[model samples]
Target: MRIRIRTKWNNQEREVSLEDTVSVLAFNSWRIGMQSLLEIENENFQTDTQMQRIAVLEEMMAFLVHLLDRIAYSSLNDSDREALVSAFAVKLADHVHDNARDFAKGDHRNNFINKLNIRLVDYSETTWANIAQEPGFSMGLTFGNHIADALGPRDKKWVLDYIQQVLMPEMVKLFKQVLARLGLINNEN
Candidate 1:
């Protein structure tokens, strides 16, 4: 028998099927994968095992909230930034739609997806607004100043270069590894 899992985002309903004997962690991992795509762009973000778990949850929540806001304001003019956000939302929505079973319960499942949907809906608007208003929203200029202050003169340039190049790619790689371990990658079909 198959079980159905339903989630709603931006007032749209998405459903997925499960084998009727899947584990909860498996489902959460898929949900985490759908969430991770929003933050790091690529799945190679680096971190340790524990850090990876936390990052997955954090990034997923952040992305969900962000996407909810973008969907809500879909009528607004599209800036380059908005375009990027829309792309991410489309990708995540697709993933969720494709992998409904990974998040659905095997037995008389209840509450998990419903609770997550509620939380995402309730917090997305405020979270998006706060992130947009953040002082460090800009990349090169704002982050450059932050880098200089954080790294001192002797290593400022090198540190900034590392952050843009090495660190970001490493992080993406690590994220992918975590997703693999969590069984999100192989199940995508």
Candidate 2:
């Protein structure tokens, strides 16, 4: 499927095919989430086990999917938006499940989907719009809270600050560029 996006220059509109874009985004989100995980681990965040690290990665992927959904809201119709996000989530789940099977087993895909569903509910309740066009405080806080909960208690106190202050903003900025480049959203947004 293809979605149309409005551009800044001359207010012209362009199309982006969701077929290839969704797969690329799935991989990119996973890669970036892993990079973030590595950064967090290097910072002495206590993800002591592979399971905990995988959980954190799933949280990051879910957040990216939610952000992408919000960014596409203005451009795509409801059905198209649902299709894009759903497909993205499935692909992300597959990536997570496949990578996690070595240490974690028993329907990791469904587990990821379940967690994503719960997170989606929480995210939906958060204010998508604020005085600034960026993601509202509630969204970031909710995400930070999830990641903090997934990490070890020793570093839990610092995880929220790190996630909200450093990690999320960096991921948002990166995805914003990716989305714009894909014509999923305009640069100005």
- Of the candidates shown, which would achieve the greatest TM-score relative to the real structure? 2
**Each candidate: RMSD to true structure?**
14.5, 6.1
| TM-scores for every candidate against the unseen true structure | 0.25, 0.87
Clashes by residue pair, model 2 = none
Per residue, candidate 1 scores C-alpha lDDT tens digits across 19-135 of: 211233234334544443333334233333433343234334333334334432533445733544444444444344344435442321222244334444544433222323221
Worst 10-residue stretch by lDDT in candidate 1?
16-25
Decoy 2 TM-score against native: 0.87
Worst 10 residues of 2 by lDDT: 1-10
- Expressed as tens digits, the lDDT of each residue in 1-189 for candidate 2 is 012222233323544457667876776677778878988988888888898899999999989988988877878899999999999999999998998998966899999999999999989888777333467889999999999999967877888999999988878876776677666777864
* Model 1 misplaced stretches (Cα beyond 4 Å): 1-62, 70-113, 121-127, 130-189
Q: Give the TM-score (vs. native) of candidate 1.
A: 0.25
Q: Output the lDDT of residue 87, model 2.
A: 94
